[model samples]
Target: MSLREIKPGNHGYLYVNSHPTGCRAVVDRMWQQAPEPAGDRPGPVALVIGSSAGYGLAATLVGLRAHRMRGLGIAFESAPTERRTAGAGWYRTARTAELAAEAGSDFTFINGDAFSDSVKEEALDRLAAGFGKVDVLVYSIAAPRRKDPLTGEIHRSAIRPLGTDYRAKTLVFKEGVPQIGELHLPVADEAEREATVQVLGGADWQLWIDALESRGLLADGFRTVALSYVGSDITSPIYRAGTIGAAKQDLEDTARAINTRLKGTGDAYTVVAGAAVTQASTAIPSIALYISMLHRIAGDAWQGTSDQAVALWDQLVGNAELELDDEGRIRLDGWEMDADLQAAVRTAWDRIDTDTLAASADTEWFREQVGQIYGWDVPGVDYEAAVETTVPWPGSPSTDA
Candidate 1:
């Protein structure tokens, strides 16, 4: 295959093509930018579901680079074909392998649908054969739909409000220019609510834990965490008070149930992460607007996914004590939820329109962050250079492929 520069082929929230070289560079920067490990601590074997991009990938990198742990990551990603490139997650995984190798860490990546029973079983077998047991499990799967492995039923998640139509000012692009837009989201019906919970909730996390324990693959002092989100007042109507919130509530409940099942053997907690630009977040109405303004206000102090991951490791394994809320969930969004910051954000929100968007928000930074998600706008990368789209992932071939 001949080398060629790859630009993002989709608009708004999704990217259909990725540049392998640029993706690797982004991963490399994250790995390098991470703080050094605290000490010569014994490495734990970690299993990270949805461990290819976003917070999942960040968690995997934290395990390998910060704690020196061996890891197994399960992510569903596309394989490259003759006419197209694989997703950014594929290239990120490949880069992870290289960094892990340099750090004397080992990671076994599985490319398959994490919701499937077959993939779960394969992970169990791999743990039994290669690592013996897993000390940490990070559940970070984010998908639009999930297929029930036992009943063959499919559930799709929704982003609608719970009881009323939600209207919010959102960030949008018109003819390649950033502007303010509005979103009017309707209420989610009972069926849609249930489906959202089934797809995005902790049902899968519970199953993964149950399977590991049933097979005696959980190591002593085991710990698990599922990523979560709780939007601030700015996005409460469309986010925290919406269908996605219901799913997150279920996730919290599952963590509690999993803790009870652990019964002194291990613990489970839901981690509410800080706001950042991710593919999933992009899909959420007003999130981009909020994040962009937040970035502008917070400047360099804002926590990127990598920063959040390092802080997570500090709480989970390092010396820092876990900052728990009243509900016993870990809080990583303290900075994002600061009172003064919120006030500033709201003030900026009220002032933003297409005419004022450029001056009011960090639209350039916002666009750059979105572009980097698909490996397009990383600094120092030669986008003019030719590159291969058929980059091989350092993992098992996808079953579908």
Candidate 2:
């Protein structure tokens, strides 16, 4: 089979195989922009949970290559080979290791379930010998469901509003047409909110930190952050004020707890990033529609996942004072929630429909961005070249992929 013949999988779920050319392009972009370490300043060692794609993967790159930090990544990803499709995250993790090896940087990737106590223990085990004194921990998990290791209780998060139902125009972009329809989500009750928090909240984040500190694994000035999103009034009802919002509120409270516990030694905070058409975000009905409309209005300003991650790395590592909001959360969604930009987006949101969607919505751009997530839209790669699928997993040496 030819590489160019590899297309996106069903409903934007997986890529049949890893495209070597496309995968290389993804990591190369990070290396090209990677910064050098300063003299007299050794890079900080970092531990990145959910370090497979999106901000998690980008943060790994920034820490290991851009900031010259030693990095230990924890993620759950699959491997690609001649007979089967591997998720986009597989390529993201593999390519990052390949790049790290080329530069002779210390980058260790452990492909295990990160939300488990055993996994946390494994990380602690490797901290002293593999990489010492983790100075930063970046939590970027985006699982839809999680099973607690202690209780064995499975928790699922639903994307719906609280108090009252919500109705909005949802969108799905296709090859040439945009499918726009009204999506209504019934209000979630107390039980659903609790489940969402159990799965998506910062409990696990706090748990990992406590485990690390208990073992004396964290170095001085240690800091941890979990990414979040609280968008405009347009998306507030279904997003910022919904089941997901309840979970985020719990995350904020957890960050406060962590901060209070670490008072003089370290700090934990939640950073709200910009709205992007992420693989995870695409799963949310109303969010996808809003982002399509947003891209249409902010054509030049439609920030993608990498944009948010890269900017975040620069700000965090640039040696400047961290700029935070009233609640003490880092605000990285400035332009995304800009009053004037959102006013324009609100106008577009009110008029968006299937008929107007093709012309008025940035479906084409949205489609391309989605494809890029799975390493499909890269240019100059001979997708038709006779393929080789021998890429190895990050920690294993069999090269089954």
Candidate 3:
């Protein structure tokens, strides 16, 4: 099939062939901008969880581009191939490895459930044998649900205000229209909520760090960071203040715990990042509508996923001192979610006419943003080229078949 025939949700295969040249362009820019190692040591090694797509992938790219760090990415999903779609990180790892090879830097990828103990052990073993230790660790995993490895029970999450019924306007991205809906907060028993907390919260993070430390895989002066978002009060009850909020609270608290573990080790610290639209973010109710309205109010052209990732990378690695409020969380989304800004967006959302949504709302730009998440809309390449690819999944032979 031709590249144009490839759909946006069809894994990430189309990215390899759709804009091969543009992909090369980004790789070249990364290589040129990447800093050189000060000494004879191979540059710092970075391990990024959730490094398949969104901010995680951007962090990996930035490590190579901005810091000249060799990286190992751990992703839970399948890798994308020319004939089949793969997860976001899968394609990203493949692409990054391809670029790193050309740039003469080390890049390895592991495909497994990062939350699994076996996977953690394998990853530590690989890092120990290959790089000895990692100088930076980035945790950006965002999963909606997880199976209890011990109990084998499935748990799901909901987006709603805790303890109160709330009504909100939601945007139907495909339809490009606003739909008002009632969101019922989950009334699941405390056991379920606790399970959700255990699965989605900071336990996995703690496990990763503990495993790495036990294996002696963390380098001295290393920095470890995790991403979290506390949306505005409008979303507080459902997100920052709800069950998920509780989970995020645990995550934030875990950061402090991890920080304590890293202290007195010369230069270790933890960071909690601000909000941005990611694949995970788009799945949350009311967020798309919120982002659409915010995009209109900002007036500056909206950026694609790659653009947002680049912005975040610039902030985190290129400029580490992100503007923080008294609370210590980086304030990028705080500025975006400022009361005044949100009020303006709320007004714009209210003003959106139902009949003329195509003209009234920048649906085209939103669609492009969605497309760019899977590497569509990139420039300077023929989407018709046939490109072969491979992922690091075990027993999967590297093939052009």
TM-score of each: 0.96, 0.92, 0.80
Error of 2 at 30 (Å): 3.7
* lDDT for predicted candidate 3 compared with the true structure: 0.62
Worst lDDT run of 10 residues, candidate 3, spans 10-19
Q: What's the number of clashes in each of the models?
A: 1, 4, 3
Residues 49-86, candidate 2: write the lDDT tens digits.
99887778777887776577776888887766556656
Q: Per-residue alpha-carbon lDDT of model 1 for 1-401, expressed as tens digits?
A: 54666566867645678888888998998887677776786688899998888899888887798898886899898988877888889888988988988888877899999999999999999889888888889999889999988799999888899889999898887777787888888889999999999999999999999999999998888989999999688898877888899999999999999989989889899999999898788888888889988999987779999989988888877459988999999999999998988898899888888888887788878888888888888889988877877767785443333
**Order by lDDT, highest first:** 1, 2, 3
Give one digit per residue, the lDDT tens place, for model 3 in 229-318.
776666665677667776777877787787788775623223444445567777777666566566766665444334444455555454
Q: Which residue pairs clash in candidate 1?
A: 4-387
lDDT of every predicted structure (CA atoms): 0.87, 0.78, 0.62
Candidate 2 segments exceeding 4 Å error: 1-5, 12-20, 34-40, 173-176
Q: How are the candidates ranked when ordered by TM-score, highest leading? A: 1, 2, 3
Best TM-score among the predictions, by candidate number: 1
